[model samples]
Target: MERTVGMSRPELIQVADTVARDKGIDREEVFDAMEQAIQKAGRSKYGYEHDIRARIDRKSGEIRLARYLEVVDEVEDELTQVTVAQARRKNPEAEVGDYLVDPLPPIDFGRIAAQTAKQVIVQKVRDAERERQYNEFRDRLGEIANGLVKRVEFGNVIVDLGRAEALLRRDEVIPREAFRVGDRVRAYIADVRQETRGPQIFLSRTHEQFMARLFAQEVPEIYDGIIEIKGVARDPGSRAKMAVFSNDHAIDPVGACVGMRGSRVQAVVAELQGEKIDIIQWSQDPATFVVNALAPAEVTKVILDEEKHRMEIVVPDDQLSLAIGRRGQNVRLAYKLTGWDIDILTEATESERRQEEVRARTRAFIEALDVDDVIAHLLVTEGFYDVEDVAFVDLAELTQIEGFDDDVAAELQNRARSFVEERNARDESRRVALGVSDDLARVSGLGGASLVALGERGVLTLDDLGDLASDELCEIVPSLSESEASEIIMAARAHWFDGEDTAGDSDAGNDDAQTGSDDAGDSRTDD
Candidate 1:
């Protein structure tokens, strides 16, 4: 026997209400979807060319199906438009551009038509559900989402979050952590994408922010704004580092994060599958902050290269392995945490390097100051790193050194000053000989030595300097930063615009003079 379904208005309303409730969508939306589906079936039965529309009464649950023919001054599509004269015959008052609805009898859906209507309703409901899921989860990004494991496919876990499903890619899950169906899992809402199929909610357990969030949850001070996490770096399932600060000094930010008897930090570590966390006290000074970030490994000395954002940490020989950790994980996390490139060295190694630098400086002094090894070594020991330092330093400073009186100090200072002056005069003359312009020498960051270096490299003119990029200038002058080079280049290019403005003013002045002469001639002619 052929299957038959209820066709009454009440029956249709009940079906819509039940579907709306089951699908968690608005009843009106469900009704609208049903009307569209009914209209599709009606057109298939009546005539494909006719403009069929359907509406369901919200309160009475009456289904009204109509075929609308548009009254137009010109009829091009005969199925949808009718001449104004023909339309007036039906209502006697119908004007052009009016729609006349012709009611059709109820549509008794055949097998093919019923299937098509069913597909349409299901598709509409599915689209509505997807939209709802996307809207709900988009605002929840960066928050912790708790859900049950729905399924596992090809190493990726699908989480059932009640209202929607989320994906936990295999790489996002912490190493060695696995989930089975029905397992209660918690992860960070890493992303939510509105794809064509549906909303894709990506969850992650290994993200660095996930650990930071866990700390915020476990430490009430962090959540209450008393403590702030400045930065976090993590090797998921192995180790992590966090730099935190506090506005209140008495609060002891690191202690607060550690909690009473290590309770607070332990809570976060437990959540992270026993990953070790080093809670560092953040400092405004990058050198201090870097030292703290590499804690538990005594830092003998820290040499900062602020321009490059790099630092060198000297530690004892035995502490090297601990400072580096297994496979360099500790230093790696510290580098990420402090945002600095770090070079770790042993104290013995640092001392050897220092000796080598001292010897090299002593040799340079001997060559430049025309002094013996003893005098050059003494100069190096007195903290004179270069001939410039010796030439510019106070004569009193040299006299204070042992075996040096006022006369000896005066003689040494004079020799240093003469050497520097001669070297400068020679270099300046060479720069002039190379055709280096005075404008090129006037660049703020370029010293005489740097200008000479540029001259040596065939960059002798203002135009040559302006055309050189920061990196290219750095090749000529190694100490030049990109910003410094940019300023010099812009200064060189300033003349280009100044010349244009100067010429424009001259032209304008000439035009005014010519016009004034013409007016004077006209006045004389009138006289």
Candidate 2:
């Protein structure tokens, strides 16, 4: 005996409502999925060649099935198209473009057909649920999410975020942090991606922003925008540093982040598995910020090279290891936080280096200018390091030194200029001997010494120099800074574009040559 069970229309509507509510999707979408399932079963019961459609009444829950045929001048597809004459036999007002809908009889669904319909409905619902999950979490990136640990797969954690599943990769978790099923966990929503398998939500507990977000949750001032987090550098579960600033002058930013007796910062530390945090007040000055960033260690002096954005910090002999931290972690974090390369030294080392630099400058001055030790020491003490400085600087500056008169200044200037001229001639002859072209020598910001250096490194022509990157050129000539090397390379490559400019007349070429000559003169004077 064949068993046939009837489902009432209202019960169908109730099932759709229940599914939509439970799956957090729209009821209309569930109804459309149900209609598609029923239409598929109808096609199975009848011939697959018929044009069948199904709809459920929103108010009355009535099921309506129909076969639609298009009225055409002549029928091409016999099952889906009918002739106008044949269509008009059913209704006198039938036209060529109108659709003639024929009411379909109720389908007595078989067991196989019912099983197939259930599968369709289930798949459609699953698709809608995934879409909902993706859209819900995509906008929630860079936020803290609370979830339960669903399982562990090869050291990676799968988190259940109530409505969706997220992945916490093994590398993203704090080192040695373990999770078991049913454990409550919190993580930062690092990213969300839609893939063929499903929407993947990636979480991270080791990100620096995770600590920042945790602080924001625990500190009301941070959440209200009164205290701003400028930067954060982390060593995962071991240590971290945060730079914060205050918008209001009266309120201390570091104190606010630390809360009363270290409450706020302690909360964040607990969440990060006891990762020690150093909360430093941010400063607009790089030197001050770096000094504060390296805490628990006293700094004796600081030397900053503003052009290179590098700092050399000198500490007392006893404070060396403390300032450097264990294995240089303290200074490394300070470098990252301040965005500057840093070198740490003790007071004794710095003093010895300073004396050696003075001796070197004095000896260079004596050799280059043929001056006695007394005059060379006077020049070095007056802040003159190179013969070029003595040759090109204002005569008054040289005369201002003690025991120096106008005659002495003039003679020194003559000797410095003569030495520089002789050195330039020697370098030019060396460059020519190495087979370097005159075109490369004429590039702005490249002196005779730089040209000889380039030739020694096998850069012999304008095209050869133009093909080099800025750092590569810097390596070839260590005297040239990165920016200067870049400018010289760009100048060498200017000829490449001259062919493309229709308006590049002879006068334009002359102007370019004149500009290069003027820049070359400036470089010589500066040197």
Candidate 3:
């Protein structure tokens, strides 16, 4: 039987190699694990008090356990309590306190102990393999890799990643992109996690970097560094925005991506399942860049508020529908790409633009005023229409604006004072008969045009304004629809009534009459 143990060594070696191969562990690792487990079991089933060591002979299929003892002058522990005379009896040449390594016969561990040892060995081997796999794949994150679809489990796809299986979760797979069993697929190695079951390899194709990688693969210009993608934003399966720049001035970045008759972009679009791709030329100037971002729609102006990182984009009246896109998609993509909040408006909606232009022209006429075309545009943003409008503005309102310090604001206040005094003098002379104040004409904050409109409607004085019904004002002002007309009338009446109330407390007897008029006004305004 002892001879047979040595002769059948090749069969045992084959068994170890097969087990190691199946478990993806080194055969030496398995043998080492087995030796450790056997030594531990020997100490557990026998005694730790007895010194023990174990070794497995590779060629003999034999496991040897040896118990050792020191030849001591006096015995202390009974398990290894051999005296010098006792140790000399066994080894014959032992001296005092000399270690004696005595080989023991192969001891049979019962079925339960043997099974436990096997389980520990197998678990250790699996743990070693798992750690090795985890380390190998953990370094591969963000790299593109090719693998075969091995199987589908739960909702995740199990891919054979050469040395291990990678899981492609349902969410990680691109929309409408399918994988068949045994079919080769390319994906990005997103992550690797070590778990008790094994190392988990994660693969992804829907990541934003995946799109860049795909472009790098298909577009030689991008790969060769002739064209650079500056920025990209995507609403997956619907729309995508890419800003591209070119190293070669002659090469149009958008045209290069579109290819001949939309071939290149079509390929990428096909991969993304008909997702709309908008390719825009990258510009150093933010204003021009924004206009490029909102293409197929002409922009009248792009006003950048750099402090807020926002854009007030104005398009022509006819181009509003196109610039806003179907449900605001065009401007939305532009906003996302530029990382700015875009407020879109039409040129027609900017009612003060013409007046702003007149103010800029008037600045050339006014000496000591250093205003340019851009400042004129800024004035419109500040709601200053024409030079006349500026003539009526208060110093307080001017001081509120940025860069309009107390000194500069005071200068504007002085300039308006001359025009204001002249107009006020003329109106004060006519105050009793015409019932008008020249100060009203010089007030820029309120609507000077609305005052003129009220005057044209036979509102000659404050008393006339107080007497006019709000519904009648609504009917006269074509621009002021019913609700807007009522608001204006009530405001005018309140201004007139406030003056009347301040004149006398004895007018308290007319309180009921004032209340009746107010009720009538409220009824008309509510309509």
Candidate 4:
């Protein structure tokens, strides 16, 4: 049995009021939706194409519709057009193109039409609410906001951003940190998106701007407009390099950022999982700025290689290690801060100062390789002065040596092969003995012989290299490129060792073989 649920006109008004309240829509908007739905449904059901007008009484809650007609001298259509004479009978001043809204008797709306009207109004209300929310949030871009963590699924965080939801993906969050439901967090409004699923708000904590924000929070100088952050670069969770400048000459940007005993920087570092922060003084000159960026190491000079987009920094022999940092961290940070590829060198390589000393030392080392005296001298002059250095060199590079054809290069390598091998073994052993712990072998442009020579010359440590002027080293070894000297010297200092005897038994065997061969040759001639 079908149940009879009868609702009067007043009851329908109360239902509409309840829906408006529940959907957070204004009463007027609800009324408009209902009126439009009702007229459209009724007209479609009755198959009327001519102008149909509808109205709802504000106080009485009564609904009305009528066919509209315009009184015209020339009738364009029979249904909607009426002659002036006929219209004059209804109204005395009825003239051409005047519309007449005549009320028709109430027509019972069918059940299907009523159902269609209700559905359309409800859908319209929802669509309006979505549009209102989208417009409200769209104007909020670039602002910081607080959100509650709703759920974390598949490394993607869903946040309840008050009126709507936003996504805080894994990449946006700092590593190893998590948010639980109900946790209120602050993030920058990285992006706002509109789609079928409504507006998408993207939040980020790892953004470079995030670091800038943290600094702005801690530094009073920055807050008070005395200082401004020039730029920031981050390897997030590892280290960050920031360039800051002060408008007022009285304020030292680095000191202001460091705060007494590092209080200011420590706060930012704590939020970033103990990540190291380097606050550099910003300079208008790119060269000076880069030198500052590669801090804790003295730079002898900077040569900008514009074509390669790299800066070659020449440091003192001792400063090379510090300038390059452990595992190239210093140079890497410098690059990040300055937006340039960095190649570090010692001052000796840049200037023509240490030529005699490096050549004298290089000759001693290269002659031990069993190569021709001229080649040994050439190797030293060209900065390939050690056996291991020549071994590390590619065949193509060795061919670059004057008077060295492919065959001569091959012969040179063959003759000096044992020396190179022994030298490498000794270097490794020395590295272990002296506790030289760098991955310098990975650097393509540096020579192991030059590094060993640096070590032998008492430039045995990164601290030592970091202290020497890059120009001094460049001058000492005029044949070696400034970049090549810097690389080896820097590597040596980072992985320095002393009291290493890598040259022990290996050198003994080589000397013994040479003596025995001479003895054998003399014996054969006598027989």
Highest lDDT scorer:
2
Between prediction 1 and prediction 4, the one with superior lDDT is 1
Candidate 4 Cα misplacement greater than 4 A, ranges: 1-31, 48-99, 102-115, 217-224, 255-267, 305-309, 316-330, 347-527
Count clashing residue pairs in model 2.
0
Residue 240 miss distance in model 3 (angstroms): 1.8
What are the clashing pairs of model 1? none
Error of 1 at 49 (Å): 3.4
- Best prediction by TM-score: 2
- Report the lDDT tens digits of candidate 1 across residue range 1-527: 11122235877788888988887888888888899999999999988889998888777677778889999999999999999899887778888878877877778889999999999999999988888788889999999999999999988999999989999999998899888999999899999999988999999999989998988899988999999999999999999999999988889999999999999999888888999999999999998998898888989999998877789999999999988889998899999898899999999999999999999999998888788999999998988889888898988899999999998888888888999999889888988988899988877887778888988899988889879887898788887777777888899889889999999999999999999999999999999
lDDT of 3 by residue, 1-527 (tens): 01211112356577778878887877888788877777777787778777876778887667777776767888888677578888777678888877777666565777877887888787888788888799878887777778899987766788997878888998887666677799887777888888878988888876666666667777889999999998877766777888899999999888998888988898888777688888899998988888988987998887887755788888888999899888888888888887778888888776477556666655742532445555445555687755556666777887788777888767665665565566556545544344445544433322444555556566665456557676776555454545555555566567666677776654775787799899999999999
Q: Give the distance in Å from residue 55's predicted Cα in candidate 2 to where it truly belongs.
A: 0.7
User: In model 2, which residue pairs have backbone atoms overlapping below 3 Å?
Assistant: none
lDDT of 4 by residue, 137-164 (tens): 6787666667899999988888897767
Model 2's C-alpha root-mean-square deviation from the true structure amounts to: 9.9
lDDT of 2: 0.90
Which 10-residue window in model 2 sums to the lowest lDDT? Answer: 1-10
Q: Rank the candidates by TM-score, best first.
A: 2, 1, 3, 4
Tell me each candidate's TM-score. Answer: 0.80, 0.90, 0.56, 0.55
Q: Report each candidate's C-alpha RMSD, comma-separated, in the order given.
A: 6.3, 9.9, 20.0, 22.8
Per-residue lDDT over 1-527 for candidate 2, one digit per residue giving the tens place of the 0 to 100 score: 11222234877889999999999999998998889998999888777899888878776677778888999998899999999999888877989899888877667779999999899999889889989989999999999999999999999999999999999999999997999999999999999999888899999999989999999999888899999999999999999999999999999999999999999889898989999999999999998999999997899898998877889999999999999999999988888888998899999999999999989999999899888989999998898878999999999998999999999999999999999999999999999999999988888888888998889999999899999999999898888778788888999899889856846677698999999999999999999
Greater TM-score among 2 and 4 belongs to: 2
Q: How many collisions per candidate?
A: 0, 0, 0, 38
